[model samples]
Target: MPNPPRLRATALTATAVLLCPLLAGCGGDDPKDPDLTAQKLSWKDCPAPSAPEGGGAAPSPLPNGGRWQCATMKAPRDWSDPKAGTIDVALIRVRASGGKSQRIGSLIFNFGGPGGSGVTGLPAFADDFAELRTRYDLVSFDPRGVGRSAAVECKNAKQLDTYLQVDMTPDDAAEERKLLDGTESFNAACEKNSGAMLPHVRTTDAARDMDLMRQVLGDRKLYYFGISYGTELGGVYAHLFPKNVGRAVFDAVVDPTQNPEQGSLGQAKGFQLALDNYARNCVSMAEGCPVGDTPQDVKNRIAVLLKNLDAKPIPGIPPRKLTQSLATDGILQALYSQELWKYLTQGLYQAYQGDGKVLMLLADSLNGRNENGEYSNLIPANVAISCADDKPRYTVKDVTAKLPEFRAASPLFGDTLAWEMLSCSDWAVPGAAYHPNVSAPGAAPILVIGNTGDPATPYEGASRMVKALGKGVGIELTYKGQGHGAYISGNKCVRNAVDAYLLQGKTPAPGTVCS
Candidate 1:
């Protein structure tokens, strides 16, 4: 989602940097129910889920032999031309526990991937909806080009391994060529495998699908809880159909004003911050903490390990070696949440002892790579969707020239993310219009959640979104906590703020900070 190049490691925690890319709009339309044709949805018992975390990369499919009911809704591939073709968008619904009398509305949920499968991830948040269960039928879907929907599949697991292992920090023309060739190859794989849908899966198109879902559900307005890249989709929906908005909370805001590189650079800084945080904690603990005696010491050790692995990838599992890329990926995965820092500590200890298997496995887990090397399509879908939505403002030459700044952002992760920006430079399809500005002019007050110590989206981005949104005119709720997102990380203050906003149509005062 936020990390367009999914292979790039996100240190500190999980889910990558979606809070870093997703947006808002104005109001002019009259307030009345939308009168549009609605489609009927077939309901049945839901199926079981293959994996809850989606291996941190792709959304695992719903279990073929499980409990959750599943259904399909069709939308024209090209909304502009309904005659062109059709694609299926998958949906999973948890009917309100309360009788119809208690039902307030239908709340649509999106778990930030730009590529992450909302349908596959439906169950995890089933509990998040616990309080709203009686009042809302919580529904989530795999946006086009993901999960049970028409997915974007590029390299298979093995080929993906080949592509990901390519050196991100290229020092010579040969390395640069290898990096470009890998990008070209991965892009070509996507083109070859997912060409048809690639052209149609723009964020705007997905927003249109949301409108259709709203109409089909027989609702005049939309109630949504969007996280990370989901914020992108939600923000876009608000802009496109500002009048259709109901109660919405965009937790972990993504500054839609930022282009790909700027967002990535910001994320680089966030990861650096997370790394420093982790290092400080690790050093303070001393024993069993492999990072070192001080934050600088920890940082240098990490750089040394990456350099060593880059020169010589150590043996990992039988077939998979721990390359610099995988090692970095493992590190980044830990950065997504503070909870994973312990695992990072253990992995680093093993890695320092010459056993990279632990770190490599950690990387695999984040990328949704199963033990058998069966990779999930999350990365492929992420690339496809992100490329469709964004085109780099800088040329490949420009990106390379900007390396110093990227490096200056985070010595541990700078180039890894910088090189990743090249994927769209030679994308198979041209991207949509560039600028995304969301001032949500006439819409009801919207809540933008920001974690003060968030490593992915960063706190200032939230403040920026609110300012563009006209400040309290476009509200912001702060979580003075650590991690990529605050709402779902057991922070009652953040959760209550979100609940109050969605359930009671309440907005916290501007600059309200929750610890």
Candidate 2:
């Protein structure tokens, strides 16, 4: 399951028939680069990412009959001004093994993260979509300012250490100031280092980029598989190009209707439910459990642990100490999947024993920190794109005002999720108006999948998405399971349904449930 990216403020494609009408602006006369049109990609051998020391090379995620090769495409920095400037788009494709006889065109993917790197993530998808790849080119790209694409630069790894451990639950004026200061400092670094790309990275622009990808890739129609934030992109694309949306699948759906604060409230409750599920399992274990006999008791114990950390952080893993903020992130990360709950339990157990290394490691994994103490640009890119797409949020004072309301919504995680979003207030650019309404009236039926116990994008949002896209073209499938993403979960029925939709534009009747 993809980790839910920490929230903030603000923040693909094609070919053949000039498939995107809206991407070129109204009447399709926004701008032009005749030279950029009709260019075919020159695919080359895939570049290998660095592997861990003594661990040898990481196995390629490419499935049988597929060989990975990559290409670069030039996209307009501002679609409205094709001549103003351009950005290099990094793309990876695994050509269909069925050859020309059975080819169905390219199937693009966006694995959430408003910041997840497509090139680095392609292999796992390649393996998962192996069956579909037999008849389609499996394609994905890091959106502008992300991953292999020109990344959004911000704080250095060492410089970012202290920020992660700040007290996010800030119990007093001084603690709140520290939290605000840390986010403000991080924002300043991003603006100073990545100002140029920030404005151009909005979701609307990214949607336009998808159309450019389609035109260049030679696909007359857009076919995609988007999870989490990818759903946000795909949903926007559908609104813009309803007629061009061929077959799109969005799982672990993130609702666009909710404002920033509402989004946080919903997610906090989602994680709280997931944590309760983890707690239930933990309490039932044969040996001693870290907390108490029930979920509330577990939460009480967690409160004590976080309170203690705020008073005195454990000196952990040389050069980095365990702070309450990092510990909260660590716990949040584990809440994504039950498979990782074991690690959360272990981390909590170790923490209670006066060591914070395990949870710190989990936070590092969620933040994309490497074993070498170096960090990926995931956090920076996530913030950049999110701030560009979302509505502006409250400051420390404003957020504090909403604490009572949020706390009532999620007693365990309300504060952190709400305050973490304050980072958006320091964004370098303004956001597009929040999309409270999303409907693709003329688009093909879009399948919206949700995991009942998902920690990040909760089940209710899936129902909301279905209602918003309710013009007889939205299909909702439910997974009664525990995890962040259902498609990748261990449910055969869910997998088959997803595969069927992607392969044949077929969706089971709405309200289909799989356990």
Candidate 3:
């Protein structure tokens, strides 16, 4: 579920532990220093962006749906070494939908992936984000290694399939060997296929690309909305070019300093926490709830069921086979959205009855498996980006040493999740592994938002980011509900507050708590 990684603060000590050396990189120079001049530009005075030379005047309306047009911008591949190679960024703009008089310049949005596609995000959110669209043109583009732009692609699907097939929770040496060997093969393939682009896909490089997009749009500043992993990109942007940031919102922010090794392990714990939440409030209910009284009971039952599936997987299902592994695979897929919680309930009901068919369907969904035996491009893209962006601070021995803690933190999925990082163990590029202090000297303090009950991005992540930014205030918006990405999801208070901030340059009062 960690498509990309985002912001927030908390009341509890939240236990910010450097518990592992892998998680130890967050310790560095404090980066909070605001730029007063940029902060002073009220929403009214913000400059409007002009169309690029090739694109037509007046953002055009599209036949299919949301307005779309192509635009291009130039940026330094490495900002510090300004004379470094130049990269061309391709952009797609969706003009706002409200009264023309109320039009604002641009509101750039990112779909969370250290390498996610932002090209179609605006259109996807067109209806839900009507308010945001009215005043500002929703702008997004392919970050380096993303859509319609020069993307980083892996040509070896077979090797990747082997890695994906590896047992997430290896029970013995034989399985472990398979995991290690598959990992190495995938790594070799990436290195062999992706050369220079692999290293450059890091979150920092993507942020620099955004700054160039701003200049191309001809806006003196940027109005942004970043979710999940997009939050980290936005944070790095705020840290590097604060002067160019206008009213920015980072919802579900990841602490950039926390690299993938620690972050994924921590995420394993977060997922278990979410499972606990679902078991408590969702399971015992009359309609769709899956479990018998206790959360532990449900978990124990699931374990037994998975063991059975592993030993004797259901028979042939065409090109893609369904085994005990795929049944458990379905469970992980159901965790992505609360909307699918009912599906989980139903799958569990069937699973308890020893019917693995339904669960296989669910797993197929999660694994990006389609009905025609085809798989989604998401996983391939995910592996490439995640492996590239995160530094494996832990070695195989390092991971083994922490098994006890991982298990304690996440019994059902921790070991599997922890082992997931092995994908990068054999990666071709030893990523720069540099975590910079992102607080720019003169950037406006961007609003970092977090939801209390988000399953994918734990509330603690937001708290860590808000605290790290030092000066920026953390706005805790209690959805008191479920699902990920809550900003445009209809919590009136949250929406109104966000709208006011982007449209009027208003920051919710310090320590603002919205429910």
Encode model 2's per-residue lDDT on 137-169: one tens digit a residue.
Answer: 989888888865667888887776756766777
RMSD of 1: 4.6
Off by over 4 Å in 2: 1-32, 49-65, 286-291
Winning model by lDDT: 2
Model 2 poorest 10 in a row by lDDT: 13-22
TM-score of each: 0.90, 0.91, 0.80
For each candidate in the order shown, give its overall lDDT on alpha carbons.
0.72, 0.73, 0.58
Tens digits of per-residue lDDT, candidate 1, 297-387, equal 8889889999999899988877778988889988887777887788788888788888888788777766666666666677877788778
> Against the true structure, whose TM-score is highest?
2
Give one digit per residue, the lDDT tens place, for model 3 in 126-175: 55567787789888776766644555555334443344445656778787
Model 1, global lDDT: 0.72
How close to the true structure is residue 510 of candidate 2, measured as C-alpha lDDT? Answer: 90
Task: For candidate 1, give the lDDT of residue 112.
Answer: 72
Indicate the worst ten consecutive residues by lDDT in candidate 1: 16-25
**How accurate locally is residue 35 in candidate 2, as Cα lDDT from 0 to 100?**
62
